[model samples]
Structure formats: structure tokens, C-alpha cells
Target: MKASIALQILPLSHSADRLQVIEKVIAYLQKQPVNQVVTPFETVLEGEWEELMLILKTAIELAGSEADNIFANVKINYGQILSIEEKIEKYHS
Candidate 1:
């Protein structure tokens, strides 16, 4: 894969709205071509570099629209990275 990113979107909104915003972002992320691994606190995506960036941008903005503000924690690995499948294969049941 050309890139992989771990994106955590923290939306600063009331409890009622915060979860909906996060779910919205996750739903959008799931539909993309990128391989997505959604954990309790973050979503990891593996795909081509440009594709990943564009998806990340749209997801952040999607959450931002509903929340007062957002705090995003992103960890990016570009070039010669392990595919999401390779990384998690051993852990799968």
C-alpha cells in the first residue's frame, strides 16, 4: 500500500450529537475503496496515498459540520507500509 492512516475524530458536541457525528464519519469511511479497520477509538485505513488523503479530508469535514469543533489525531505512514490485512491477520479469529 502507498499509505495508511489511523484517524480519530473527536467531535466536541453534546453527548446526544457526538456519537451521531462519529458514526456518520465511520459510515462514510466504510464505503470508500480503502480497507478500513474500525476500533473503539480510531479507524485505520489502508490505500493509495491520494485516495486516503481525500477520504480523510471529507470525513473530517463531515464531522466538523455537526460539531462545535473537532480534535483530530492522525497517524500517517507513507510508502512501503504493511497492508491492513497483513498487520491484523494474526489477530483475527
Candidate 2:
């Protein structure tokens, strides 16, 4: 993997179960090989750029299917030799 992507998906559901939809997406992401961090506003994933793109597509589709509307906020950091662990390891004891 040569790149990392942080994807924050917000599903606008007419129903009150919006969090449920987000949780479903998180569960799906958890199954992938990408290193992932779930935060209050986004989920950061690190892995191959191509693989991450594919996963993004799947995540969007899954969220769309589960909600009436969806918004995805994506941030990518690339072109350097790094990994998710490298970026956050220092913060961990």
C-alpha cells in the first residue's frame, strides 16, 4: 500500500436510525485489510490507493442502499513513504 485515505461518510436518513446506517458502514470497513480508525467525524483508513478507492466505492454504495441520502468527505495523503501506524504510533504509549 502506497497511499492512505480518510473517508467520512454522512448518511442523511429520513428515519431516526441514521447512526445505525453509519454503524453498518463501519462494520463493513472493519472487515477489510486496511488500517482503520473511527472517530466522531470520520474514519481514517490506510492501505493501497487502488484498494482504498475500491473500498470507498463499496462503502458509498452500502451507505446509499441503507439511507435516503449520503455525503462523503474524503481526504487522501499520498506520494510519501508512510503508513497509518507510523502517523499515529507516537501518540500511543
Candidate 3:
């Protein structure tokens, strides 16, 4: 894995069923190959850069198809850094 991406997807639907769209997106991401951590506001993914990018792109497309408007905020770190597990190990008992 050469990079990590923190992806935050916010889907706005014309109807009040926005949560359903968000949940569907999350479910799709969870099935991907990269290591993923789902937080309250964002999902952290660790893996090859290209693979991560694909996941991000697909996520946006999927959510946008289901919702009226979808916003994907991505934070990327290049080069090899500590794995997600390393960063949170201290907080996890």
C-alpha cells in the first residue's frame, strides 16, 4: 500500500430517505479489498493508490445515482505511512 485516503461521502436526496443512500454506499465500500475503518463522518481506506482511487470514484458514482446530490470529500496521504491500525492502536484496548 502506497497511500491512504479518508473519504467522506454526503448524499442529499430529494426525499427524506437519505440515510438509505448513505448506508448503501457504505455497504458497497465495505465489500472492497482495501482495509477500511468506518467512522461517524468518514471512512478511512488503506491500500494501493490506484485501487483506492477507483473505490473513491465508484463510491461517488454509486451515491450520486441514488441521491439528488452527492459530495465526496477526500483527504489523501502519499508515500508509505503508518497503517490505520498503527495510528489507532493506542486508543484500542
Candidate 4:
């Protein structure tokens, strides 16, 4: 089954520039095999839960490396497409 997740990442220190950090994140996501990952904006990632988690983890790691003062605020929500709602409901139940 495929699900969508949303993430919000922000850098933490005053000395850390937001634009530069965002740029690094954009570059990293662009290189991934998954073609639709978005950055500096809301993104809806479609993949298995485990695969999405790995992608998120990698994003955090890459962002962290860009600056010592960097930090990420991530929020993820999971839901299947309407066509698969029945399957999702069955899994949840």
C-alpha cells in the first residue's frame, strides 16, 4: 500500500541561514530516485511506510550535515488514496 507524508523542517540557529539550508535540502531531494519529493513547500510522498520513513531519515541527516546549528521540525500524516480506502480501513480495523 502507498501513503502520503508531510514534513516541515527548519534550521535552528541565528547564524544558520534558512535559504542556504533549504537549498541543500532541495538538492538532496532532487537526487533521490523518487521524482516527486518537494521542499521549502508542502510535499506529499507516495510510498510504503518503511520506504517513506527511510527517505525522511535521510533528509534529516543530510540537512543536519549542512550546518552544525541545524534542526528539523517534521510532521507526518498517513493516508491512502481514495481508491484504496477500503484496504486502508481494513488494515486500521
Candidate 5:
């Protein structure tokens, strides 16, 4: 893979809307052409570097618009990266 991005978005919003906002972000990511693994805290995306960055930016923007503010953490491994399958394939059921 060209890169992998692990994104966690924390949106400051009403408790009622917080989960909805997060769902929107994940929905957007799911539409992209990438390998994805979603966890309780973050989502890991593996694909081309540019595509991943753009997807990350758009997901953050989508979250920010529905909340008071957005705090996001993005971890990127460029040039050389391990895909989600490569990291956890053996553990799959």
C-alpha cells in the first residue's frame, strides 16, 4: 500500500448528535475505494496516499460542520505501510 491513515475524530456536540455525526464520518469513509477497519475509537484506511489524505480531510470537515468543534488525530505511514489485512488477517475468524 502507498499509505495507511488511522483517523480518530472527536466532535464536541450535543450528546444526542455526537453519535450521528460520527456515523456520518464513517459513512463517508466507507464510500471511498480503500480497505477500512473501523474500531470503537478510530478508523484505519489503507490506499493511495493522496486519496487517503483527501478522505481524511473530508471526514473531518463533515464532523466539524455538525458540531461545536472537531478534534481529530491522524496517523499516517507513507512510502511504506502495512495494510489492515496484513496486520490482522491471521486473527480474522
Candidate 6:
């Protein structure tokens, strides 16, 4: 089944630049198969749950590698597509 994954990543160190970290994430994702699903920098992605999880994990790792002193906070929210559709319909009414 397909799912939507939303990731909010923040760097742990105050010295770490936010824009640089975001850029590294975008660049890293661009080189991966996951980029085929959508533009690499998109905050939201729709795909198989397992694939999405793997991509997110890989992205976090890449981000960490770009800055060894950097740390990340990640949150993964999962929902079945039917629930999303129902919510969309409810909001449209």
C-alpha cells in the first residue's frame, strides 16, 4: 500500500547552518532513486511505506555525513491513503 511520509529534520548543534544542512539534504536526495518520485527537495513524498522509510533513513545519514559535528532530529508520521482521502473530502465540504 502507498503512504505519505513527512520528515522534519533539525540540526542539533547551534553552530550548524540550517541552509547548508537543507542544501546537502536536497543534493543527496537528488542522486537517489527516490528522486524519481518527485522533486528532490519536496517535504512530502507519496510512495510505498518501506521505500519511504529507507529513503528517509538514507537522507538523514547523508545529512549527518556532510557535517560530522551535526546531529538530527527526525519525526515520521504515517497514515493510510484512505484516511488522507477521507480528510480531504471532509475539508472540501
Q: Rate the local accuracy (lDDT) of all candidates.
A: 0.90, 0.85, 0.87, 0.65, 0.87, 0.61
lDDT of 3 by residue, 1-93 (tens): 488999888876676368888888899999999898999999998999899889989999888888878778899987977899999999999
Candidate 6: clashing pairs of residues: none
Number of clashing residue pairs in every model?
Answer: 0, 0, 0, 0, 0, 0
Clashing residue pairs in candidate 4 (N, C-alpha, C atoms within 3 angstroms): none
Q: Candidate 2's residue-wise lDDT over 13-77, tens digit each?
A: 77637888889999999999978888888888887889989999999999999988988889988
Candidate 4's residue-wise lDDT over 1-93, tens digit each?
565566566777576787788777767666765525464564445567677788888878877876677656665546645433443468767
Could you tell me the lDDT of residue 75 within candidate 4? 56
- TM-score: the better of candidates 3 and 5: 3
Report clash pairs, candidate 1. Answer: none
Runs off by more than 4 Å, candidate 5: none
lDDT of 6 by residue, 41-81 (tens): 44555567798788888878877765555555443446656
Q: For this target, which candidate reaches the highest lDDT against the unseen true structure?
A: 1
Residue 72 miss distance in model 2 (angstroms): 0.6
The alpha-carbon deviation from the true structure for residue 47 of candidate 3, after best TM-score superposition, in angstroms, is: 0.1
* Decreasing TM-score order of the candidates: 3, 1, 5, 2, 4, 6
Task: Tell me the tens digit of each residue's lDDT in model 1 across 29-92.
Answer: 9999878899999999988999999998999888888787888899999999998889888999
Itemize residue pairs with steric clashes in candidate 5: none
Task: Rank the candidate models, highest lDDT first.
Answer: 1, 3, 5, 2, 4, 6
Instruction: Give residue 72's error in model 5 in angstroms.
Output: 0.5
Stretch of 10 with least lDDT, candidate 6: 33-42
Model 5, 1-93: lDDT tens per residue?
499989998876664387888899999999998999899999999999888888988998888888878789899889877778889978996
Deviation of model 4 at 88, angstroms: 20
Model 4: residues >4 Å from true position, as ranges? 35-40, 82-93
